[model samples]
Each structure stands twice: as C-alpha cells, then as structure tokens.
Target: MVYQLIKLLPIKHLPTLLGIAAVLTSALVAPSAQAQTKTHEGWYQVEMIVVARKDDTGQEHWPSNIKLRYPGDWVELKDPNATEVPNTTNNSASATATAPVVDLTKEAFYLLPASERQLNTQAQKLQRNPRFEVLFHNAWRQVITNKKESKAILINGGQTFGQHQALEGSIRLSVATYLELQTNLWLAQFDVNVGQEITQTWPEIPLRPNYTAATINNLSLDSEVEAELEQALANENPQWSNGNFDANAAAPEANNYVTRQIILLQQERDMRTSEVHYIDHPALNVIIQVTPYPSVATTPLPTAQ
Candidate 1:
C-alpha cells in the first residue's frame, strides 16, 4: 500500500520527500551518538599516591619517607587545576638550624580526545596556555606531614625525581586511548622509585654495618620508546604535523618529552573507575586511580509565597 501511495505521488515531490526522510534519519541517529560521547565525558575524581621505597638484601624500606597523596577531579581536558600545596614553615628549637621548605611542581591533567591529530594540536595549545600553570597549581597541593624530619624538598609533577635534585620529579596525567584503540584510558608518566644503593662498612666481619642511600637520577626515555609514542600519535591523526612544521621548530624539548610521556601512558592499559594502576620507574613508584563523581538529580524550586 505504501509503494502504491508513493507511485501515485508527483515525481518532483519524491526527491523532496526522500531528502526529508534522510534528514529525519540523521536527526534520530545524531542524538544517540552524541549521548554516547557525553556518557564518556564527565568529571572524574582521581587519587594518586607516590612513594619512595628501597630494598636491602630482600628487605624493603621507605628511605625518603615520601608518601605523598593527591586527590582531585575534572570534567574536561581544559578544566581548572585540581591540586594545590599549602605553604609551610618548619620550627626548630635551635636558632641556627635552617628552616625547611617544601615545593611542588604544579601540573594540570588533560584528557586527550580520542583523535591523535587533536591530541597533538591540543598538547601544543595546552603548553602555550598561561592558565595551565594555574590549573596545575590547583590540581596538585603539597601537605606538610612531619615538619621536624622534613627538609628542603621538591616534588616533580612528572612522578620522577629531577636531575640531581633529591625527591624531585614530575607526573603527567591524561585520558587517552590504548592498544589497537580498544579502550578509553587514563594514563600517567613518572619514574618509579624502586631500591637504593647500599654500602657495607666492614665487609669481612660476620655482622657488618651498612648504609642505605636513596639514589637520585633523572628519568630517561629510550629511543625505541620515544619512537613508539611518536608513531602512536601519528596514527591517531595522520595530519598532526602537516601544516605548520616550521612554526614549531623552536618548541622546547620539554614539549616533546611530555608528548612522548602522554603516548606512553595510553599504551599501558585501559582506565577504569576506582581501580588503581601502578607504574614502576627506577627512582619512584606511582599509584593512580580514576573515579567518576556520583550524579545528583536536581529538585524543582519552591514557588514564592
């Protein structure tokens, strides 16, 4: 009956009718796609803990006693900074003793869209944005635990110790895609502090005195790892570096370092809510988790009396 009705319709009207039908179909499909995307995008609460551990003849210990924790949440890649560290002063009985200070390397977490091309572009823009510093400062905060034992300390946002600086490194956090694009994930970059160097005072004695020391070193990314990250970014968006090659010529080496780290995190595993993921580096161990905030239904406002 429908076919007969269509046949009876004017020929010119058929084209218009088909176009309307196509539009209707698209309108129906578009909302479902958008809704799915929205479900994936939202504020996620995160908890990250970093600790420095050492091993001595099968015994483990925390030498630097670094048990730093950061709790935060964000809705978008460009969301406000989620961490902050309060300024603190050490009080000592001896007037001659130097007052200790703690400093945190401020950092912001960005969720890279699934598109590799967009990741590169966003990465460049994020680095250039002055607000990123503020965002980072807000996301990461330093809390003073033991004022007496604590000395001059620097914490890296990258999760690894800085070169020649004790207990100073960086941590890079982002949401990305993983392995064969099979999963949407959260990733982080940092050097994992494992064990320290030990020196024995009396080697010939049965019971010898030994000294355990925390080894400070910069996190090094091998060429193979760097190439893998570069390839992954290129695959996500084939035209990532197409138009403005020379414009980025003077880009700092740190930018490339961060880009590589972002890619490395994505390659590790899919991110799940409330599940902790540990990435081990030679100088530190990083523990991170992502949890979605519970949605609350809004109630209707009461009418004025």
Candidate 2:
C-alpha cells in the first residue's frame, strides 16, 4: 500500500517544487541587482530667468532678457542683452557715475527630462508659478448663550462659525505675447531672520553679508579702537602691524591696512561670481536655495542674470 501511494504521487510534484524554489531565488537576488544598477550622474545645466517686479504695486509687469543656466536638459532659453547700472550710492556723496559691475549670471540646474513639459510651459506662459492654497488664518466668532447643566431650564445654545484665509502669490514675467511655457512653483515658505550673531536663537556660523568692496570706508579708526585693534593684530601676527608704532599716531596706517584687506576679499568674491564658463548644451530649471553651504560660507553669490 505504501509503494502504491508513492507511485500515485509520481514525479510531477518535483517540477512544481523546483518552480517555487526558482521564484524564491529570483526574489532574493533582484533587490541587490537593482541596487547595483542605480547611480547618479554629475550635475547638468539648463536655462533660467530672474523675473523681478517692476512697479511698486504687483500689477504692471515688464520683461527683461536675463540669461541663466540650470541643471539638466530643459526648454531652450534665449540670452538677453547686456545690463546697465541703474543707480549707485556712496556714504560721502551720491554719484550717477559709472555703475559698479554686477554679474547677474547664476548657474541653474534641473532634472534631465521633466515628467511634463506642458505643465512647465503653462506656468511660464500664465505668468504664474504653480502654487498650493495655504490656509494660514482661521476666523471665529463667539456669541453669548447659556445652557443649565442642572435640572433648571436650558436658557439657550449657540454655534460658532469660522472661515479660512488662503495666501497666494503669482510669478511675473512679461513677453511680447500673453503666453507661458511652464510654471515653476515654490510652495515652501522659509522664515529668514536676519539679526546680530549674538542674539540669534538657533546655532549659526558667522557669515559675511553681501557688500561691494567700495562700500567699506577707508578712513582711520578712532584712537581707542585703533589701539585695541593694533594690540589684537600684534597678538595674532606680529608682522601684520608694527608693535612699536604709537596706536593713536598710527591710526591712519592701521585703518588703511584693514580697509584694503577687506576690499581685496570683496573683490575676489565678485570676481568668482563674474567668471562665466559655457557648456555644449543647456540644463533644465532645477530650483536650489541660494543659501551658501558651510564649506562655501564665503563664496560669492552666483551671477544670476
């Protein structure tokens, strides 16, 4: 009877068992194969624009040809003509003289191929970036009413009503025709609190603010300040300033040295921002915050034309 039962089972079960084993083996190996295949290529370039509001109110608009490149392949963007300095100011006096050179070129990047170009086009053509409605405020009203919790007569019952307010803003860029290619949306809001380093709540590394070399004055420091600064300088580097020189008397010399060093750094930053390197193709409109990384703390802003 046992032999008969074994024969009835036959060899067909072996193939089924083998098939199940094969499937389990494939499942175990597939994830590693996928992981081995995935890698990120280096950053790419695309085109972008800097659209600023022209009027005091957010109504009227004017389009200027600003040329910028971003990451990845995207829509072809045209470079605008050169820019001119509109205004220049100085502490001593205001002059309409030669405007300081401000390179407006910034490197923009994007994914190689966006999922949908139509959406991108629609956003640009409509002069509005895609945005989500954010309910920031809720309004409420209260009415006087009374209801007896005890066995006494229930005086009254009231209901409260409320509404939500949504905050929305549009992107502005004018062209000859009332058309756009796509919308670039920035849904996130970042609170940037600018204050002195000592009073900040969050841990922050000191960063130099944006300013031109000429902005810093070349005048000498006061007697007391100069004396302290001279001492500090001597402690750090004896060769930077002569220790024997009278602090009050050498105020002019100390001031000139400090001022020139600052100016040099400012100029260096400006030069880096101004340098333009070209690639064979354009990139897509990838958005990255302009905030500098810790390592690049002192790097100049990208020239975003």
* lDDT winner: 1
Q: Model 2 has how many clashing residue pairs? A: 34
lDDT of each: 0.29, 0.22
lDDT of 1 by residue, 1-305 (tens): 22332476576345433332232232212111121121243334444443332221122221322222221211122222332333344445443433322212222233222331212332333345432210121122211112222112212333322221122222323333310111112122322222223232111101101112334232233445433434444555466444322222221122233211211112234444444444333223334445554423132211111
Query: What lDDT does candidate 2 reach at residue 296?
Result: 15
Once model 2 is optimally superposed onto the true structure by TM-score, how far is the C-alpha of residue 251 displaced, in angstroms? 14
> Model 2 Cα RMSD, Å?
30.4
Backbone N/Cα/C clashes per model = 27, 34
Over 191-257, each residue of candidate 2 has an lDDT whose tens digit, in order, gives 2112213321221111112211332243344544445555555665566565464434332321122
lDDT score, residue 34, model 2?
Answer: 21
Roughly what TM-score does model 2 have, to 2 decimal places?
A: 0.15
> What C-alpha RMSD separates each model from the true structure?
25.8, 30.4
